[model samples]
Target: MAATGHHGAPLLVVMGVSGSGKSVVGAALAQRLRVAFVDADDLHPPANIAKMSAGEPLDDHDRRPWLETIGEWLAGHDASGGVVACSALKRTYRDQLRHHAPRVRFLHLDGTPEVIGRRQSSRPGHFMPASLLASQFATLERLAPDEAGEVVDVDQSVDAIVQEYVDLSAVG
Candidate 1:
């Protein structure tokens, strides 16, 4: 894809609960924007991964370090811009990430439990299991109007989602 717009922006965080296609869509968005891509999952500490692998929902305490690491990455890439796939399920978590990159914006991948749960079940080899989908949805807080972002429905094709994101970013 061509990078037509979205230049001079700070980091973009593709966010949602489990199975929202953050990684897939995020990578596409990064390529379209001509920026590097990072998966927040890759930054999680071993203990957090183990906890999720065992079907446990992580607490704020458990996620703080991981979130901070992601924030640091955003800070590091502020100049060049980048995209990161993270489940910034809570407003506070998003705030924490914003602290690192003040100009950070988010692309929320929204979907219903039925749709997302189905996707989770079909996936494999991830630390988070289908069982944890409930917790992820339960913890998710939709983007506020004041937030510098837009919500793209995950039901659409990945290309459509990316196009919508590009359109939105161009306007933003």
Candidate 2:
């Protein structure tokens, strides 16, 4: 079933740098909200994946199409609502997403680089290498005051993070 809170079915983007637990938290949040979940990484074009796999940071040109694809997904799910895990690391990127999915809300999983880097190192088989984490951090723009979003500390347990969102959404 779709979320039936004051906001109705909510379009949520779980966003952060690599290893900030976007995927884990997004999945759990979607389950709790009874909404569908998707990992934005899966929507990337093969070239983007290959560039990241080779330890190269993707430039805006490479990410534009990918971001548009994600936006399209959000548009398609606007009525039903859904959760997507994505590294929406720049204000412009988030703006682009909002252009396509105006009602979308973001959950930024924030933490120190030391904490996140360690987590990135531990993950194997992921296309994004730890070497490029610095680039991601450099690109990240925290949600502005006017943005429809919340920042959650990634240091907390997954359940705790998910619960916090659940509580916040309940009040809205």
Tens-digit lDDT track of model 1 for 1-172 = 2333444754799999989999999999888788899999999999999999999999999999999999999999988889999999999999999999988899999999999988788788878998888888888998999888888999989999999988877777
TM-score of 1: 0.95
Give lDDT tens digits, candidate 2, residues 1-172: 2233446687999999999999999999888887889999999999999999999999999999999999999999998889999999999999999999999999999999999998898899999999898899999899999998888889989999998877766665
lDDT of 1 at 93: 98
> Which regions in candidate 1 have their CA more than 4 angstroms from the true location?
1-7
**TM-score of each prediction:** 0.95, 0.95
lDDT of 1: 0.89
After TM-score superposition, the amount by which residue 148's alpha carbon in candidate 1 deviates from its true location, in angstroms, is 0.6
Pairs in steric clash, model 2: none
Relative to the unseen true structure, what is the C-alpha lDDT of residue 46 in candidate 1, on a scale of 0 to 100? 92
